[model samples]
Target: MTLLAPQPFRPKSAQLLSGLMFCWVLLSSAACQEDGASVNCTANPEQCGIDVEAVPARLYVDPPFGLGFGCVLMGCDEAKILTLENRGGGQLAITSVRFKEGSSEDFSFALYNDEEDPADEALEHPTIEKPLKIKDSRTKALSVTYKPTDGIADEAVLIIDAHDASLPYQDSVLTTVEVPLRSRVLGSVAFVPSTDTINFGYVAPDETGQAILTLENTSENDAVLTLAALNLTDENDAFAFTFPENPHANPGDVIEVALSFTPSEYQDYEGQLTVATNDTAQPLIAVDLRGTAFSEPGIRITPSVGQGIDFGAVRFGETDVWELQLYNAGGAPLTVTPSISALGDTDPNVFHMGSTSGEALAEIAPLESTVLSVYATPAGGGAQEGVLQLETTDPNNPLITVTLAVFGNAPMAEYSIEDIDFGNVVMGWQSDVVEVTIGNTGTGDLTIFSYDFEIGSSPQIMLGSAPDLPVKISPDDDPISFAFFLNGQSLGPANATFLLQTDAIDYSTARLDLTGQVVSCIDGCPVANGTPSCEAGYCAIGSCAEGYHDTNVAFADGCECQEERNGDDIGGNCSDKRDLGNLGDDCSDHAHSVTVTGNLHDAEDTDLYYVKMEDAGSVICDTFGDSFRAKVELISAPPGLALCVNIRASGSGCGGYTDYYDPSYCGQNSYSSNGSWSSDDDKEVVAWVVWKPDATPICTNYQIKFRADD
Candidate 1:
């Protein structure tokens, strides 16, 4: 009565077997069924009609489980292929292929429809919204790339979503797959240069010249450079190189190297400069160097013919010429050309130059010579100088100059005797002859016509002897002599001049001064108040008498004073007596006795008297004075005469002391009137006054009394 609902569809064989088994099992268990439970197919599977099965989805990657891009340099990119296969026998749908969580920024993923050329079928965008379909036993490709900005190891994974069409009945189901990616970034180094050669131009020997070489680094990292060795073909080690110490350069950095060249000889020089670095492409770099050395010329000049050429002195309007030689003492030829055109004053009249061939240029070969003539004509009288300049081709000295000097003089004449002096001449006498030397002290000759006294010259001055008239004296000649005399009758100084006529242009008539002094007869005599007599143009004087002296230096005063007895005043009232000891004189008279009165001014005063006794008698001589101490000395008379004296001290005011000639005549009777007269000659007696040096002036009167004993 209850019909069973249709069971799930199943295979025919399985359904038939399952139906038979179910009928038998139902007969066996019929008694166990309850009366109210009819055939219930919902709860019991044996009552079902058929059975159905569902399909499952599966995912497989072509590279199994991972993908890698290998190691690469920084700033470079690498790519790899990732494949997903549908192995579950159904249409596979990929919804998206993207980077998973915890993935790095250096990794990327993209989907491609083409299996053979995955790069050609890359998706425009990295993420995909439309699902991709893959049939059973088919595969899909994904493009994965790794790029880094820094040097580091990187790893990432790609996530894929795959769906199965057979499992469409189910919801929220997917096949998830991951493909791992990894990579490593590395640093690169390189080196480059701006140039590879250096050239040093012409350089002098032993002098250094330099050039520069530049180097650069083209790598993305830092690098170091070092110089190894610099080789040169120099015997004297003339080439050199200067490099930095352990140079470290960064990216895009440039360095400079200085290379110098110095040659020892005059020749061409060549060398190489090498630089080493840590570049992989090029480890060593070489630079070529070249230079040249040359020699220079020198110049020297000297006098050709002699030490120097002198033009001497010439007239103002005259011209003088001189010659000088130019010699080349160098290894090269010396070329000379006149530079007269450059002179500010190139007057041909003042200085003129001429060559042997009259050429403007002069060339002297090595060890050869040439002549240079110079003429100078002064414009006026005096010293003049000029210069001659020449230009040459020598490197050391390019210009040569010579100096010329000349003197211009006018006609002139001079005398060696400017003045003449006849010192002193006595009246009525001729002076000693004085010679005057006349010479030509000028540059020209002196022609003398005549010589005479000047108009104002005294008539007593005359030229006694001279050179003949019309005499010529050349320059620098020995002077000639001329004698002159001075005779006058007057007593005074006299001056005159002697005029000489000459042919000199400057001095037509030269005058020479003559000076002299005339002295009178009294002045010419040697003794004062002496009788002067003219003898042979000189005055002679007689000798002076005794007891008289001339104290005045002037000739006008004759014998002026009587001789004093001592340096101090011997006060005596004696007359001026100049008589010699003649028989007729006052002191020599033997007929009478002599008596005199005098005064003693000081102790040093002395008085002298003369006496003569005809017949021997008592000769008594006595001296009396007041406030005076007198000392008397009596000289012994002749052989036929005898004398005596008496000595005594009167008082404290005055005293008298006598000195006898002999002790036998000392007594009072010593002068007895007993001898006869032998000769009528006078005898001398002296008296002295005694006083102290400090005594005041005192005038003491004294008297000498003389009497013949009768």
Candidate 2:
């Protein structure tokens, strides 16, 4: 083919075109050369344009250019097959294609064609495959699988240092493709609750409740869910909150939390719970806790019946004590107020045992009870009754009352003389009479329908006159009478006693007995039978004739008068002495010098009567040695005198006795010693005595003579 085939010179336009073309070709070829080799080019600007800027080698990915999730596999997961197209204007030569050091284990790739397979050592330099050529505008596919560590970034860059033999080393291009670190996240997040809410109703200050949250795994993989926050609130200051457990959540995990609320100074309340977690878009979980709050329950009282007390069947002014009990059964403490009131016509102040109205009585804790006392005192004397009412706020059981009873005054009996005495009555004397007044001075009625006169071995005595038999006395009425009679025999100075009885009185009967007596002789004088004791040893049987020895002597002795002396019985010594004043031997002779003496002290006074009677000794003598005369003397006289006597003579066989007369002048005349005897003649002195009694002697000058002596 050495034939110089077309040396034929052409036109100048073609040559000029060739010269310009040659110059253009040279510059254009220089622009097209990678290292030093020529490249086919055209002189047209559009065809042979020179671009100095490095254009990144790109891929037209037909298959999975973007990262995708992987199916779950053994230890972890993997992601997919991918393809790339060489769409740049130049042929590409990939020298090394690999991931960075830390990212190398995250991916693996397989060439789409056998010729595109990079040698194993290609990853040593620039960390990729060995150098490989790809024609311009060609497609190169790969199967790329990748797996990323959990909780790490999911993307990485695959770097390829491409070199062309026609270009310099610095002129070679480096290509990188962003490949997502793929993972198979096969789980979703959900919220779970062990319980919705906890209601602690009517609780004390120290109480607690527990709530649990669970993070459930709906997929095949474990999930990490985080808790952001937790909240609790209440309506009043009555409640507070606390958390005793952690707020973390994991897939298929449950967390138990304790919530506590303490009520402070409040009655009722409501509370809520809020929990926030990272698993859901709206992470807050709300729970409502509710219950009724109570303080303590108290007892309210209202009396059962009338307020004014009427103690039925009870006497007035009677007092009774009652009781009331109350309880607090609620969860809190209760304060109680106890009051006393009388219902109906009764006065409030009439019946009272407890504190006043609105007085706080006691404070009771939960399940505690207390008792109160109420006193009811009536006002009047008849049957008094009323009701005791208690007031409180308890709606169910409000009021209460208690019945009262009181017994008042009863009647008692009274009598006049508690003691009586019967003197010198004979033994078995049955006609001894004494009167006792029975009266009922009290407000109650008394009855004395029968009369009973009880006596010791005496006949049944009549309380009234003889034949009337018995008497009935009434309250506040007059006195009653009774009599006992002697048994017609010798019932004398010794064995004398009796008692009067009553049927209505319950106590012992009224009785009388002798408590005193007198002896036959006095002042060292010999006494005989039926003889009165000598009055100062100066009394005898006969009368004291005119001008007798002393004016006190009852009789004259032998008519021989003795000389008189001025001495009187001073100091009561009864001895004759020469020391005598002008005092006369009269009753005034015993008086002191001055009736009103030194200091004028009062003298004890005594009034007495004594009988001096003639005995058998005087009768046998036929002379007047003993006499029957009652001596009237002043022991200690109170400026006066009282004289009276009733004597009975005991004669032998009821016949032999002394005949006596009542003598008028036993001593000096009744007037004085200086005066004459009111009787002048010698009267028949039988047995006689004179007295200054209002009952003068029946015989003014008579004396007794013993018939036994005759």
Candidate 3:
């Protein structure tokens, strides 16, 4: 519910009916209120009609805004009527009706068919000749409209020329009436918003998120705003909108629109909400909307793979336990449970998960890890084999299995880091080193008797920093170490595995897998011109050898789009200006001598060129395609040579083009006198711009051809 503003007391309807029972008011011996076709002749000869909101200039020191049209939004218009009632014994002649001199054209006066009815059929602006005759006790009405051309407070006098037969005429507007009109223009639409864009970061599938778009009517009291439609645009079926129940609104009435986004897919979603209304200034408004949904979590178990884990050197009829780490590597939370798998045809309850470690895990956040333990109690074996199973919520890796083995009084060997990733490596640059610590967590001594290396299609993975072979690691003692890095020898994916052999009898071999990519220059740069290259894994323009410069610091389009030129191109700044030595020297030397053509390249690129007219008496320089986009100006002519330039060019940031005629109001198309200049000081050199004067430069080819008369 909208609350109404308090209005000042105006017992205009019946001021006498208040406080007192009643006043025996009498007007010409008639009842308190009555207005017949024939009014009393005892009153003033002429009075303002009831429909007109005006005060006589003689009565009010500073009269209120005529017709009280108040503030009206730009691009919108409001109209009122001025009525004159004749209460005299004779006819009233209205000679003319118009606004005062110097009054804004925004205000206009026209004749009307009826004062109270504005229906198309009843409203007419037909011209009326001077001295429109009004019989006694009759009323005449004139319509006035206020449609501001600019936003500002304005005041003007509305003059009504008249002559009453009952009064003798005098000099100087003998019978004249002036009504002062005052109004402050408004610049915005009736509907105002709380926010222009709505973004719902991320939501899971089947879940919904909501945002509110508040729209308020901030126009005048009578400027009623009506909502025609409210909903999301096409292709946005996932988002829904609930609008205010009542679609009509007056001043101060607010509408809080609720918009909800429920994405069903696992990718980014985009949409827009359109508010269609009856506001003449802005008929439709659009708000940007964005969100994402449905992300999965990836699970990785450290120190594990097929035959990758070992509970080594356990004595017969004895138990030993090993710890395993579970890591969530993707975007969402993960849930997992650890258990042991039975091999074929064997009562394989010998190797099992620890009691505390078998409990199901839940909600593991991304990049975070949890721990689990497994026990190996060998009965009788040279080496007992078993497999560990991990069930997880990762859609890609639901069931992860790692082969395990137990031996009697044997050495156990393991590598500290199992997986290595060198994110990105330049084609010929070496990657960062990753160290792998080898250690033994068994009862007996661990001996690395030998080692071997294997590689994928691309052998860019270099293994180094290894300790001497035949290294021995006593029980619970420090282990051997090694290092590896991506050598970036070629452009392709690099993969390799290094294996180490130990004295442990079961699962005794240990291996470390390495992976990375050898990328080429410009591999990650987005679309654009120029020879792009990557040095330290970063994209950039390689060289200016092609006569193309990356003047624009954006890597998306590489180098070419920013600045490209052939041999005919000139420099961008005044320092690099092209000097066209001598542009003829005579008045009427109409030969087009210097012809220069160049591209604007971009909005910020300004091409400056100079010419020598030292001996010329007069000159005329003009650029073709006279538009605000590629505006041309003669900065200054040679001191002794009088030059004429096109004065139509302007450097304005108000908008993109010069609407010299103001077709629809693009912006402030203001121009200074610099576009047109003349000088005869006989200076050495003067230059003109292909132009850099302002930001509205057109990004296309511009040409100039002119003659200097001698």
Identify the leading candidate in terms of TM-score. Answer: 1
Cα-lDDT of candidate 2: 0.39
Candidate 3 deviation (Cα RMSD): 43.8
Q: lDDT: which candidate is best?
A: 3
Question: Local error of candidate 3 at 577, Å?
Answer: 8.3
Error of 1 at 575 (Å): 18
Report the C-alpha lDDT of model 1 over 577-606, residue by residue, as the tens digit: 211121112222343333344443333433
Candidate 2 per-residue lDDT over residues 78-172, each given as its tens digit: 53544444444345565655565665465676665422453323222322334555654455554566544322224444544454324654665
> TM-score of every model?
0.26, 0.23, 0.25
Task: Arrange candidates by lDDT, descending.
Answer: 3, 1, 2
Cα lDDT of all candidates, in order? 0.53, 0.39, 0.57
- Alpha-carbon RMSD to native, per candidate: 36.1, 38.7, 43.8
**Model 2 bad stretches (over 4 Å):** 1-64, 70-76, 79-169, 180-190, 198-211, 217-273, 277-282, 288-710
Superposition TM-score, candidate 3 onto the true structure? 0.25
Predicted candidate 3 versus true structure: per-residue lDDT over 1-710, tens digit per residue: 11112112122345335533222212111122223334321232222112111211111111223565665544557777766655333456566667889877778777654567644343332222435656644665676788754434456778766655434444322355677776753443387877777767567777898988887888754455667788787495778888777666556876678889888877656688888876768888898776667367777776755556777777546789887888665557888877775565323766777643456766777545687777787765456788877788989999887787777555566668788988777787788888998777665567788877753434678776887878888766877788888888788888887877877645667777788988776563443545666664656666544545454456654454334256344554445656555443333242324666565544444445544332223224322211111122322321111111222212321112221212232112221121112333122233333332334433344445533432
